[model samples]
Target: MTSLFQFTGSELEAIKLSVGVAIYSSLISLPIALLLGYWLARKQFPGKAIIESLIHLPLVMPPVTTGYILLLVLGTRGFIGQWLYSTFGIKLAFTFEAAIIASVVVSFPLIVRSIRTAIEMVDPGLEDASRILGVGRLKTFFQITVPLAAPGIISGTILAFARSLGEFGATITFAGNIAGETQTLPLAVFAYMQVPGREIETLRLVVISVLISFVAMALSELYIRKMKRS
Candidate 1:
């Protein structure tokens, strides 16, 4: 019974790395997503369409292409990468950090879109009333706007986490799929698939992946329903 569910060392490593990367990716991207979502929803500025198009480019672009671009810009010897390594001796390429970055890039658009829609649905009258009552913009945003849009933010965060857990092409490309380091669950599944007699392991990972995604979706749906009810 316990043996049936026991994970091998490599499988355990993959699961841990996947969860770690996904969590960090989601947490790191949340603030940026919130800012972008609010700006896109409530503010008007020049080149807004251009900014939106760029933000969503990852959704349309090949995952490998995005990975390649990251490698060029953030690789060990690349521009910012070189500077960081020289100044602080920090290397990003082929590391867990790179995997987190990849997940953030690919999942960012979805997070931003969800949050933007949620913010847009917030009542302008509430914000106006807050302002009329001498509440500052920042206070109103944190107090009223954020509370009202919490459902959407939570949904987007879960979706991003699910997406990060399933990330493959970008992670493999930028982070090199190193076992016990950058190799996440999706990469582990791909590795198992390439070898003979590893079908069981591959299938196990597939099941795990599907379950995680299903749970995330279910939670998102529940949030949407709750939002509707409120």
Candidate 2:
């Protein structure tokens, strides 16, 4: 079955690009997730629910819709995109960078949910005690709150990366399927599926995608179990 396991150059490129995008998106989402998670866990205010709904909008909305929105906001002719291009000559639509943005947008909510739950589980008494001892909020958060929330953060990060890895609709719609530039593993699978006698190629990428997603989910689950037990 070695023959069946072979990956073409384009397929390998897709895998590499997917992994890089996943890592970048996860890193980008983590700090944002932490702040939002902490606030959602510890703070209450009017319009909080509305703010949360907005944050989690991508989770409920169609991926294509999300991509279209991103395109409108960041596409070459978009107002912001227009400003960016006029000022810096940058273009976002249908590029490698757009792929990363699409992944970040789609995966953001899952990261927030994971982190929020983790932070909420941490005892408020602990933070209060730290403040009573005159520890600065920043110090207390990094030293105490973060350590306690580590598992969830880790879990959330992994899940975010995993979501990025399997991202299809948003990435394709926003970034387009430019091989070695914007084409990811899922996109590669989709591309290969359209060709006759490319079943093996399609299956190979599908298998790789499944394996990567499975590993990420397994790791996330492990941390979740650990977080609960603590």
Candidate 3:
């Protein structure tokens, strides 16, 4: 089992990259998800249904399909991708950024859903009282709404981080599993599975991924419980 304790360079890199991507993806998606969730919870605008459906499409679609759509939009030769490349020399596909983007797309709907539910559950009268006291909407949001929705926000962020850590199909499809760059735990596990005598490495990565996901979920649940009790 000493061999199992010994981590290969690739394994360590994969762990680090996976964590970095998960963190970046969670941080990047939070503000947008917060605003979008508040909108979905509070607004009754025309075409909102269509917008929400589009936002949630990734959740229902096969991850590969989502990745393919991102590819079409962001690839070097793709539709708008060509314009981006011609204008800015920016090619997003098969890159570290692409992996984070993939994780964000796939995990966004879940975060939004959680936040929206939390916002909806909050009493509107509280917001109205804040408004009557001359608090601006933005201030009220940060001071009142956000504190009340802290449980959901924290849970949603944890869920996003966990989902990003375990992301595979979209990441692989868009980022191509390049080691020490776009490769994460799931990708590393996949790679190790393909190599002979790599069983230990694969097992270790799998255990790590599962443990991380479980801990994230547990933390979310515990925090929710504690908040409710208080």
TM-score for each prediction?
Answer: 0.95, 0.96, 0.96
- Candidate 1, 1-230: lDDT as tens digits: 34446679999899889989989999998999998899999999999999999999999999999999999999987899999999999999999899999999999998999999999999989999999999999999999999999998999999899999999888998999899999999999999999999877887778878887898789789877887798
User: How many clashes in each candidate?
Assistant: 0, 0, 0
TM-score of 1: 0.95
Q: Over 4 Å off in model 2, which ranges? A: 223-230
lDDT for each residue of candidate 2 in 1-230, tens digit (9 for 90 to 100): 78678888999999999999999999999998999999999999999999999999999899999999998999988889989988998999999999999999999999999999989988989999999999999999999999998888998899899989989999999999999999999899999999999999998998889998998889778877887788
* Candidate 3 stretches greater than 4 Å from native: none
lDDT of each model, Cα atoms only?
0.92, 0.93, 0.92
lDDT of 3 by residue, 55-80 (tens): 99998999998899889889998988
RMSD of each: 1.5, 1.4, 1.1
Compared with the true structure, the alpha-carbon lDDT of candidate 2 equals 0.93
